[model samples]
Target chain A: MSKKLLLAASAAVLLNTSPALAASDADLAAIKADIQAMRAAYESKIEQLEQKVETLSAQQDQTAAKIATVEPAAGEQVATQRPATMQRNIKDSSFNPAIGVILNGKYNSFSENEGDVAGFAIGEEGERGTEGLSIDETELNFSASVDDKFRGSATIALAEHGGETEVEIEEVFIATTALPAGIEVKAGRFFSELGYLNSHHTHTDDFADRPLTNRAFLDGNYGDDGIQVSAVLPTPIYTEIGGGIFRGDDNPAGGAEGSDIGAWTAYGRVGGDIGDKTSWRVGLSTLQADDVSRDANEDEVNFSGDSDLYIADARAVYAPTGNNAEQEIIFQGEYFYRDEDGTYEDTGAATGAVDYDDGQSGWYAQSVYKFAPQWRAGARFSQLYAGDVPTGLVGSALDDEGHDPWAATAMVDWTNSEFSRLRAQYSREEVADGQEDNQFTLQYIMSLGAHGAHNY
Target chain B: MKKLSLMILTLGVLVASPSFAFAKTNIFACAPEWGALAQEIGGDKVDIYTASNANQDIHHMRAKPSLLAAMRKADLVICSGASLEIGWLPILLNKAGNNQVQEGGIGSVMASDYVPLLDVMQEKADRSMGHVHPEGNPHIHLDPNNILFLSKVIAERLSEIDASNSSAYQSNQVSFENSWTQAIAQWDNEGSHLKGQQVVVYHKSWTYLLNWLGMEAVASLEPKPGIPPNASHLKQVLQDIEGKNVKAILIAPFENEKGAKWLSEKANIPIIKLPFTVGGNAQSTDLKTMFDDTLQRLK
Candidate 1:
């Protein structure tokens, strides 16, 4: 007990010596005010030692040095050597955020007549820089617990397209804590937590690219500034329900304006494990959006008004050895149904507004098997097989409706370590009648610093 | 179709029933060691769910739905905190939505807090420090003394959460303490060769164990905590170990072996993989066996 007190006293003195802390007297006040209850527990003891802080910081160089000479700690927290250069701004060092970076690069080769599957528009999604080397995505992540009531995380994506670099704030969110009834509230620009794979970073995906249904309905992944609340029901089985309101800036339901939330989403999931070898989860989710100005097929056709998308996702895993790292087989699939009640405007040849009710749906299913250490193989099949559009359309609009488009993808990857992976994947794609596009890609994903655990 | 629907309805009733859920306390342990420890204390009264198994890095876990499923059902959670599980535990906790097992709750517990921590940070954390634990070294379970401390805390916590089984928990703790002390004594006598021994380690994970046994780790394979070995750092390690009487290069079974292999091949030192937790090796089926195997391998 005395040792603990003495260490705290010595540490307090060292902290008071920092010029930053000294100058920011109000910061200490805020800290004290923030922990009124905690301050009461230690205030008497700390007050008694206030007179001792000045001389101790100067004299505690040896003390810090002595502690530094001991064995270094493991993982992220090491209180190792601190040279003289680090003396000035040391107050908030203890509560600094964890930072991490992910570098994703891929090389792709695609046969030129790169056609599209009939009646399907894959959106801004396609092979990565077909026939060239490209840095697909570089992400900078920062996260920290913001007091006991909230935690904050932000991710910024950096990408270069056509010799120009672009930066996008992929996600920035603050999640609430201490909520009653097993509830959490997340606010900011974040991926909607409706589907299983929607919230995962692209770099963490099992394959190099998004699935066909995802690319179609979600325009890749639905990311928007929103407020989300989720609750876990008090029951024996694992069940969760969540809902969100978002500023509609995403695809499929793109372009909404003003203060009203453009998109509203709700979802429920139920899951559990069987014995020790098998686990499964199934979810049903829905999103409703009012697209103020929706353009597709190169602006020749535009949609406006209400649209709704419903999705169902299910996943299961069987680990024959009961150790995931050793041998595991995973099965995942998702289906989407979309209905749009909007007016389509054809600007090109037939210039008129047609009140239309269009319904489309797509699905994808994939399975991955880890047969040996450091080796995994997976295959996925996706299709944009259904859609109906109104008449009085011209140019790209007429060409956009019709038969089915489908794709099949397969990949094999070798992981050198937990932080690095190399994968080679192939895709057989058909856009329009016999417009076959053979695509191959080699991708590398390397993470540095405090990368979080990816969701399975 | 009607028969299948009827069968599904019956299954749902069984799943949602409280009697099935309350038969035993469900425990979620972030690491295998904690799972084994929970089993020792809880016995048949609890069902232990280990999030990470032997030879799997606990820092990060594959985002598996079973993880959330276990968390949702867990009556208690035990982990080596001090940010050892900082990467995955936070999101898992929030996503699981089980307020009973969130931080500061009665069911959420960290083993590092019950014991005196080693290598506690006194400096501010910064990127330049690599992966520095702001609290202290969280690998307190490696020290048998710390395990004794944790056993008491866990038993108390279990009793607090499951009052009906208080006396049983107490008895379990007593038996465990008695058995653990005896094992520690025997291992101490056998590990006398380890006293004043010097070794090279892949990471700083074994500091508590080394300190407890009066052994020393002369060098590390990593350039810094959480960072992999670099060429210059490996070169420096080679030069540093050129003349030292280091016994062997100790690497955790879960860690990448390339660095240790390189050091071993370059320095002509032997590399020994340590079963880091229960079930880490064929012989390490439990805590007692884990330490026995670790001690035997070190000797």
Candidate 2:
């Protein structure tokens, strides 16, 4: 404001200094009057500038005092790379951990009274969700860099199960941040990176429920206390290889005998872009569980032995519109094969122990299309084939009754924003011969707090 | 036969080696503008891999494996920051495990940290405000001065990372500063008439640009930031901009143009889709042309 006034005043003075070609006495008086007005404006502007200077000096003094107090800590632990102001903000935010919460709820309807699939004893969580309106797992997450060398994250899930409120610590892990040579190491309890979807949180799933293959093969989810190390290769194409060792206390793996390692996993993944609009990733993984003692089908069945599982996954995404945020189609599939040689017993039916040695496999294929910015529709088909059941185990939950289980599901979801989604899904599965289970589910998953970017 | 097979195996190993043949520093830019800026400052001494192009929305970017691979080898990582790339950059940095470009590393350059920001939330912000960044708007590259400031930062980091080419980076930055300063003066002269002119915007994407040109943003087509424009919101905008002398409805290349088109037709004003960043349009192939094309279109 003062600069413009000064410029006008200077311009007026220059005009007056120029040769007076046609200047009369009245013109001179008018010019003098203009100069007087400009002087008054300049006087007020100077007063304001002086006030501003006074305040600035006062602020400088306060800052000097603050620096004196902070100087002592600076000597003890020197903070490099971060500006002083940013450091102050980080301190003010109480360690600066990213905190987030996911609110998920669902209303489910099922035609069949029992959700159990014959021939395969799915785990507790693998069963269908609450039959009526109920809140699903609510996840509370917190993550932050512990230091320059490590970063930590934890997730706690709260849900209602069998008329009881259940709180479970789903994942808690610390990962190395500064490992050289593209190698990362993580420790603590985390989901096993067995397949593509297993590593991701269920809230990020394209459908409301896990695929039949995932449910039967890995019991909806597989998380256990473990340590994992992964390395991204230096190749131009995206390639990563990882391995993990876990305690054999989770589904597909049970009680470990003493301090021995329960399960171990190894995986390799490769991905790249096909064009400007499409990208794809393919991965192969294997998990081996030893000394397993598992009870399934509400304790009516017991299996104790070693189990080995292998998985192959493939995913491809094409953005019909250049902006994937607007429109896209995703094709994802996973196949799992498990070979187990174990002893099966029916505790409830008092069936005699039987020696079982066989292999079981399941595969699922799904496609989701985002027809509009907010709307998406998806369809999935899955089938599971069971191995031969010994005579003693025929009446137990492991009995297949010579029928393979298969399911078909269709769903449509609307995203209000990046943080919220509402979905409706319908599915039909014949887990046993001539027993069709028709299921309908309405679910909402809303995220709050920190914005999380989806991983591909 | 064994000796011949061994020789061929050695040859295959050499051929499959992953090390780069050249000595140029690897620069992973989160957006196209930073990629363009890195080019201006690093010149031929850097190999830049920009994660997102001008036609894609960086806010909605996925943490793709390809980006992870690129980040894994990055000697330097440049981004607008201030939570603009918060969704994906953190994931990439964590997964990349590259010591040079990790947070607090010498090669990390978050542009917003250096320049004064606009729209920093004064009070507690909430989700009702629509994806507000408490740190402020991250679109700092729109101001040419901000770009110049970031160029110096990028050059300094490049020098620190690849000190053997320090002189080259410094000299390149000097030349870019000279040309850019001249261009800024020219733009100031040409845009003087645009001072205080009002226009509607599709999003707050052009906050820094409008502020630099002394143009006023009368309203936004979207009801809020990150939200698509709805019928009620468009109607409200129509009423708000009525007789406000809104010269144009400004939008970015990646922004949906439907709301802008509807508003333009209803308000009888033109819709100007700005290149927004480098590679947004044919005329905006580089940093200099991006600004030049933006001003040309605005006029």
Candidate 3:
């Protein structure tokens, strides 16, 4: 009975255990299915996420491109705010070098009855024909700015001198404005500070022929190698002061050296607007040269012990309407003085010489009247006097002693523009020795392009 | 000498009067059109100067010393800045030595500033592209709408500089606008016929005008925007335009006409000469006349 009961119980237990195991298997299968479903859902979600990202990136690119297309340029807006006048006056600061060449050719024929001398290029005996065509001036100018503070200008002229091509330095100077009080410093070869005509170029002179004072005192367009400093003083009146130190030998004729053969000049000028329609200026200059050679002697002599020159100039211009281009009047005058200590050395009868202490003085006055927009008439008178000289000189010894020579000039000019001019002038020169000469000249000036400079 | 002294004294009195102490409102206009407009609006109250001369090629002017002197004393300065004056205007202003018209000064104004510019390059500007302003084309003065806006700006400036003359300045501006309106109406009437017209230009200078008139700029005489036309470019342009119904070939008086003329002759098209600026042609002395003459010439 116990065995039978135990077997029944075992069977019951087996049945219950098998049912439990079956239920556990079904639960495991359900759990596995749930895991597979979750895995598929996660994979699909990741794929969708990747597609969304790509679409967003493409939209961002499109937006960026549209932004670039719509934006206005920065430079254009900045330019629009500036004043028109200021904008019109703008300039490029970059260095753009320009090279230029100028060639001048002239031909003249005097009317019959005008006589010609050996050096003169016109006329036969008592009859003048065609004067040979001459290249009056040929020049090459180079000007540039190294930077904002430093600038340089140079001019070279090639002309026929003494039947040969001669090269001369017309202007070679470096100017700097990096100084105090509007001061400009110039160094190298440059023209001397003397007279109005002396400071102007041959092409810029009002008249074709130079004044007698310029010819006599300047001695063939005086220029020297030197250093110069000029400054415009900040004052109620327009004032300028300039000075320079030069090697005396650099003068056209070459200065003699024995004891410091150097030259120096200083000048001061004051100018101001007298009124709305008028302006005036007065200037004084002093020059000194040491150890100058005189009388063709091997030894040099310091005249005035060192020779002193004084020049005083005054100018007044009246423009009743304040438009000188239409109608105006101008008056100018200058006085010059030179003092020298006389010295002499005799070598023999073959080279005769005499010595005396003397001084020289000269003065000139000019008047100009403009009657029309482009027409002007002017007149000038100048005189020069030399103090007594020693006797026994080869050329006009007695006649030149303590005598005054004078010249009068009348001119008419027509200016087509600032760059072109036509002038006609007649002059009469009279010497103390009773020799009188008259000359008439007609001149035409044409500028090739836009190379004209401003007048100071 | 006595007569001269008396004359001098009389001249002195005139010059020393209190009325002569103040300088006139010195205005600098960049182009002849602006100059004429300034003169018309300012009347005798301001002295107007132009950077480009009537008889000169505006694009080729050299910035000279005399030009600087005029700018140095200016009370008000104006320019078409979109690079029109890029070649030399900056240098002239710096050297003019005037503090009143320098950058950031009240006296300075640029006409292009008030208007939107066109034809901007998306890439960097270089010489290979002929010569375009890196910023854009600055020739907005050709548009009448732009001029109207610019005139208002000028009136405001005039009033600021001379407060006492504000009423007069406003009145002048009103009259100028009225006249411009009348002129613009006439221009519209005439320009209506030119709509959709196909034209060839010598340079990009006419872009503003062409855009305003709704005319198509079929091509340019220049091979590229800034490059001069070569034989190959000209040939290509001619071939492209064959039987394309081009009405006119426009060229500015300042530009060399040899290439344009050659192209016109080869293409059998009418060559039209436009003034491009005030006082540029005999019929275009003032701003109103300039537009009238330009329209007439185009017709």
Candidate 4:
């Protein structure tokens, strides 16, 4: 017991000496040195504890022998002793939340600069990433069950944008756990579950970047402060229905009035296993925003009116091997159609206004194959159909110029374990007429601390 | 319009009600072993659904929507639970929206909570340790003694949940204990020759079984707990097992056998594929026969 206390004290001393804010290289080195010292101390202390335990167990065996000779219930005594050998002192963890952190970095090379998609105004975060080596987003997550009735989770992301470090709250919400009749309620800021991939974090992506369809339609991810109510219908197969009302400050919808719902959504999904080797899911969803101002092309274009979007998503997974541990293949795709009755204003280069009443559509299909436990290869193709531009706004950002945009991407990634992954990707993108670019990317993602299980 | 509304209301009522008039308590077993155990204790008084079969690794379940559908109707949730189901069980519980089977609820049965666990980490675990569970190894069902102990706990939980069938559950548990105790004694007497034998294992999953039999694991094919075997690591393991009088290389049904096969050929040792759980093989149809098959294979 004294040794345990001494070890604790020494650990505290070493921890105190380590730098708290390890943002710089010097501070990181100092922290590494501190960890090394602590590890050495713990190793020696563990040796001493092992020696002490050995002597104590020797004495215990002698005492047990003496007791065995006196007691006639030796069999029962042995039965009880067996459990003691297997039991270990466990730490109590009732009040603390599980914490996790994600580290992302990438090296990107492009043959030409990113150009706006012809006839489509793209929002921020929808464009290609910076060229060259850079640190991507660093996410910190915390989650725990508040009680039997509810659980809460929060994720904060820090990224370097335009040479400035910007911190954003990606998601923070509380969800119901005890509602009856297969009902669940979630409230606060979260990624809206409009489509299958919309709610998934970027860290869990199969490729290093979002597909072109997601970028053009949803600004990579559509999320906002909202309340969502969903229910898993009691059925032999899997079926779910859900809806939400959001504050509409996110990309697809912007500029909300106080206490007014800017957007509303409804979605339904059905899925089941075909056999032991295959599982498939299909979903349909829609989102509507009314009397809200939306902007795109880095805030150079603006639109205000009623906008409605419809989505269809499908995914199927097949494990060629009996178990997924050996080999598996996944095919996923999503189609997006948006109809708008709004006025588009060219806020930048071409200053004009157009009374727009048209529709745009986009779709992407991808397939990923896990040929081995730690290796996966995938390819994706995305294409978009531009909307018609009024005669008054022929040269505006919304003008189609008789060309549609498309991109094809291929990637190969190696996962060292569940906690770390490295990937290489190549893509040919044609965002506008006569504007073609070849892109290459090498990326690494490492997760530290407690990461919860991802939903399928 | 009025007639249409009335017809829809009647259909809604029909779908809302359960399909069966005499509904049994719904048991959602996370693995085949627990499902088999629930069968033994629940008898005809419970409706059982096993989430993952013996061919799937419980640690890497995909949290499929079908699992959520099953969990939504569960009256009891049973799992090994020393973090063995950490990857997906929590998601199912949260999404299932069934309060009675949530953690710490009466309908939740974590078998590790009742039995002692092996391979409990002595220090704070890091990912570098390769998928180590700080609470311990959650594969506790390998020990027949631990299964006997857990049976009593399950019986009490079931009786409390379904009071009208309390007597039935109690009698089933009593019979299970009697047979299990007798089987443990017979196996012990017949399998004394396995004492002090050394074997190589693909994973630490066999810890409880080895501990029960007084056998030891000399080396592992995996370099770490969950890391796949590489060439250098296999060479190291080959050298480590030299002159150790190693009996055989053991693997579970779901585990990839490529590594074990390579090592077996190199070391000139035989590979033994143990029925790690119920339905792992043709003969391992239930809990009793599963152990019988495992003991027979090991011998």
Top candidate, metric lDDT: 2
Candidate 1 vs 3: which has more TM-score = 1
Candidate 4 residue runs with Cα over 4 Å from true position: A1-95, B1-22
Q: For all candidates, what are the clash counts? A: 14, 0, 27, 0
What's the ranking of the predictions by TM-score, best on top? 2, 4, 1, 3
Residue pairs whose backbone atoms clash in candidate 2: none
The CAPRI quality class of candidate 1 comes to incorrect
Worst 10 residues of 1 chain A by lDDT: A75-84
lDDT of 2 by residue, B1-299 (tens): 24324433543454345666558999999999999999999999999999988888888878888899899889999998888887788888888778767766777888887788999999988778887788889999999999987877788788878999999998999999999999999999988999999999988899999999999999998787888888899999999887788899999988989988888889899999899999999999999999999999999
Writing each residue's lDDT as its tens digit, candidate 3 over A76-169 gives 3343334443222212212233333565555543332332111101101111212445666677766655444555668888877446787878
Best model per TM-score = 2
Per-model DockQ? 0.20, 0.23, 0.06, 0.30
What range of 10 consecutive residues in model 3 chain A has the weakest lDDT sum? A117-126
Q: Which whole-number lDDT from 0 to 100 does residue A243 have in model 4?
A: 75
Q: Which lDDT tens digits does candidate 4 get at residues A1-456?
A: 999999998887677665455336787788899999999899889989999999899889989887877573564334322132111112122225777889999999988776688888888778888789999889998888776688888999998878999999999999998787677899999988887889888989888889888898888888889988777778888887777888988878888988878887778898988878888889998878877688898888988887889999999888886577668898999999999898889877566666888999999999999998889999999999988878877877787688889999999999887788999999998888888889999999998877457577
Residue pairs with backbone atoms closer than 3 Å in model 4 (clashes): none
**Full-model lDDT, candidate 1:** 0.76
Q: What are the per-residue Cα lDDT tens digits for candidate 1 across A192-283?
A: 97676788888888898888778767766788888887766555566777777778777666787777668777788888778767878899
Chain A superposition TM-score, candidate 4: 0.80
- Model 4 C-alpha RMSD vs. true structure (Å) is 17.0
TM-score of 1: 0.72
